[model samples]
Every structure is written in structure tokens, then in C-alpha cells.
Target chain A: MAKKLLTTLTLMASMTAGAAFAGGHIEGAIKARQGQMQLYAHYLGILGGMARGNADYDAAAAQAAADNLLAVASLNAGSLWPQGSDMDSAEGTRAKAAIWENFPDVGAKSMALTSAAANMATAAGTDLDALRAAMGDLGGTCGACHKAYRGR
Target chain B: MAKKLLTTLTLMASMTAGAAFAGGHIEGAIKARQGQMQLYAHYLGILGGMARGNADYDAAAAQAAADNLLAVASLNAGSLWPQGSDMDSAEGTRAKAAIWENFPDVGAKSMALTSAAANMATAAGTDLDALRAAMGDLGGTCGACHKAYRGR
Candidate 1:
């Protein structure tokens, strides 16, 4: 679809700043989780950008981005953010101690993301207004985790 | 599972170089596609590294990595790779003109990757030998694209 093509083009324009990762910061488990997060953010940004008119709206791209976000959200990160790989223990991540210290809350927050992402995936592929609303909910879910677990 | 934990630790040590992305250099469509590839490669590396004994084979990690790979590889890249966003137009990518010139072949190659990735997703979570075989087949599918469409 034309929307898909345009979305892909728009994403191409928006995703540039995310790829310049220094290639030496957090190498192991932390890196994997962070890399996954970067991947998630890029896709979400694409959908959210489109919804806000910050970028062009392409339905296909939005759906795909939402789907990608959903998949990452559902990934089994049980082994990724290991017990000791939080920012306090690692050098390159912003993940806080709360992710492990309160795994239940973190788990609940993660599920919220997955649920929001699912809504976005369906809404994104449908229409702009739906996409916008769904994206806000998903973004809120992300903020919930960052507010409690991500540190500056 | 212990091997998976150790592999994750070793991956942490070996993965430092991938995190050095500068954060400002590449910021558009090409970057999105490349980022997706980087994500794909990271997950594949986890599996391939395990298969080769270069890293410990943690069944859970391997399965999760494969699932992640399948998810990313199966993403709707429709907008991610736009017209004129090839390597010739982009600075940090290796996609060749043949991708557009031989669109059908490119489509086929992409589908091949999807098929292989699906197999990997199914095999990785089940057993080690299945993971190894599926990975080789998936690698071959990747090579098919590089052989026909990618540049050095």
C-alpha cells in the first residue's frame, strides 16, 4: 500500500539517530536488553511520530512498527537483565535496581507494555486516530516503567 | 540452563564492541533497516555462537534469541527499505542496486529469510541439534540475499 511505502520512507528518515551506538559500552546481557529497547523505541517512535504528524503517517509502517514493538515486549527477558546486570553493576545501561528488586512490579509493567503494544498493533493498521490513542496508551506504559526503573 | 547463563556472561564480555554506536551519525530510513539487521544479527549471533561452541549453548537463551530473530526478520520492512534508500543513496548501508533491479528475486530472498527464521524459531526452543541445523539453514538463507543483492 502507498501508506506502507510512505511509512517505511518516513521511518528511514527518523531512525538514523538510533544506530550510532558506540559499539563498546554494555556488551553482554545488558547490551542485549538495551539493544532490544533501542529497537523497540525506534519502532514505537515511528508509529507515534506518524500519529502526531511529526512524521508522515503510513498505515503499513505503523502496523509493522507496532507489531515489532509487541514482539519485543513479549520476548523472554528472564535471562537478559540478569540479577546483577543493572546500572549499578553495569557501565552502560540506565536500567535501575528496581527492575530486579521488585520483579513482580517490573513484570506487571512489562505486561502492560505488551498489552498496550497489542492495541497499538491493531489500531495502527487501521486509522490515524486509533493509532494515536493506542500509541499514547503504549507510551504511558513505557513511562510507567521508566518512572520507576530507569534512571538518569 | 547454566550454560545459557555462562553464555550470556561471555556474550556480555564479547558484545562490548556492538554498543559503540555514536547516536547522531545515521538518522533515517536506512538507519531503521540497518538497526533491524543489527538486532537480527545480535540474536542470530547468540544462537550461532552457541552452535559453534564459541559461546555456551544455553537452551533458553538460544530459543529466546531465535524467537527474537524470527520476530525481527519477519517484520514488515515495507517502509524500512524505501526506493532510493539503497547503499548508493545511503552512507552506512550495504544494500545493492540489484535489490531494486531484481525486485522479484529480492522478494523471494526476503521470503526465504522469513521461512528460515520461522524454522529457527521452532527449533531453537526445542533442542540443541535442531537449533544448530536450523541456524545453518537460516545462515544459508541470509547468504542468498548477500550473494544476489548485498555489497561489500
Candidate 2:
């Protein structure tokens, strides 16, 4: 009877440990993904302000916007995802297995978008017209990735 | 002598008119760029908040950011430039002539970034991770434009 009790306890402990590990992984992914999304929103806002003429054009504002955009451009998408992180049942999640299965393409498209954004910021103050044009391409790159990898 | 005086007055009038036109153009561009810059800053702040867990990861914030970005992406850089506007003379201007020369490419990039941002927002609630990943690409597109066009 003692031997059987000990076996049961060991099994329970292992199950708990496994669950904790999985929970930690999902939480971490959530945290990283949140960071990425925030940055994306931030840059877009800056670009919108510039287009609308609502903000006063000044060196300080221009420099700040450019810098922020560059920072956003630096984020790498692949680093944000972990294997088996789909948590298939999580609310606000439509991630499919394909993210990990065809990760390379997703990564490539992400890089492409970053490169385009960087170029736009660089030209923003110096060449408003060119910046406008570049902004479009940058948007396109983002679309390409979403069309393939994003579930919704 | 009367002919000469009339000529002088006419010249003065024309000069004043020219200055006024130029000033208006400069002011318009400045206003537009300022608005865009502020939008970018706003988004960055949001992103930062999301990353630090200061803001809830929800559809509302995500959608707002995405919508703002799309609005920014739609701005036409070429239309912002007025004839005779120059970097050396214009106040609140860092835009160089290169913008016009490279207008097509710049527009394309901006659109790419916008589309990606929109996609991310659309997917925010359904798949935060996927949305995050797409945001990464969107950021990259912003950078690409900055690298080539923006100048200190």
C-alpha cells in the first residue's frame, strides 16, 4: 500500500510540473507578442500625424518620429513565436501550425517590411514626397506576410 | 519717370505675393509633417504601454492603432510639396528634392506598412501572436523607407 501511494504522488507531481512549464511558455510568448504589437501601433500613429498636418512640423518632432520608426523596424518576428505555443483554445488567437511549419517565409517578409520602413524614415525629413511613396511599399510588405502567415 | 515708377510698384507687389505664396506652402508642409510625427509618437507610446503591461492587451487599443496607421499610410508625399519649396529656405522642412525623384518607390512602401498594420489590427482579437508577428513586418517596412529617405 505504501509503494502504491508513493507512485501516485510522483505521478501527480510530474503532471503539475508539466503544466507549470507549459503555462510559463505561453505567458512569455504573450508578453513578447504584446511588445511587438505596441511598437507597430506606435509607428503607424507617427506616420499618420505627418500625413494629416495636425502636428506642427519641427526638427524635434521629425527626429523623434524617425527614431521611433527605426526602433520598430528593428524587431524580428520569428523571435516572438515559440513552438507549440498556439494554445489552440486561447481567446484572440487564430495562429495555425503553419507559423512554425513555414516559418522561414514569414521571417523573410517581416525583414522586408522592416527594411522598407527604415528607408521611409530616412527620407522623411529630407524628401517628404519620397517618404510618402516609400510608405506605400512598406505597407505592401506587411500585407504579404499577413496574407500567408496570419490566420485572420 | 511715370513708366519706371509703375514698373517699380508692380515689381514690389509681385515680390510680396511671391513671398506670401511661399510662406503658405511652407506652413502647409510643416503642419502636415507635424501631424504625422505626432501620430507616430502616439502609437509608440501605446506600444510601449502594451509591452510594459501598462495597457490591457485587447481589441480596442489594437484596432485604434491599426486605424491610425492606415490613415497615415494614405497620405500622398508628392502633393505635400509645393512648387519652389526647398530645404534650405523652408521653415519646418527637412524634406529634400529626392522625394520627388523617388516618389513611386516611397509611396509603395508606405502602403505596404499600412496594409500590414491593418491586418494586425483585424487579427488582434483572433490571434494576438499572429498579429504581433505581422506588426513586426510592418515595423520593418517603416525602417526601409527611413534608411533611404530621411536625413538628419
Candidate lDDT (C-alpha), each: 0.65, 0.51
How do all models score by TM-score? 0.72, 0.41
Q: How close is candidate 2 to the true structure, as a TM-score?
A: 0.41
The per-model DockQ list reads 0.12, 0.02
Strongest candidate by lDDT: 1
Candidate 2 interface RMSD (Å): 14.4
Give the alpha carbon lDDT tens digit for every residue of B49-131 in model 2: 45445555545445545554554444333323444444655655665656545545655665666666667556654545655
TM-score of chain B of each: 0.78, 0.69
Docking class of 2: incorrect
Chain A superposition TM-score per model = 0.79, 0.70
| Interface C-alpha RMSD per candidate, 1 decimal | 10.2, 14.4
Most accurate candidate by DockQ: 1
Instruction: Encode model 1's per-residue lDDT on A73-146: one tens digit a residue.
Output: 76665545555556887787788977765755666677678788888878998888899888778889989999
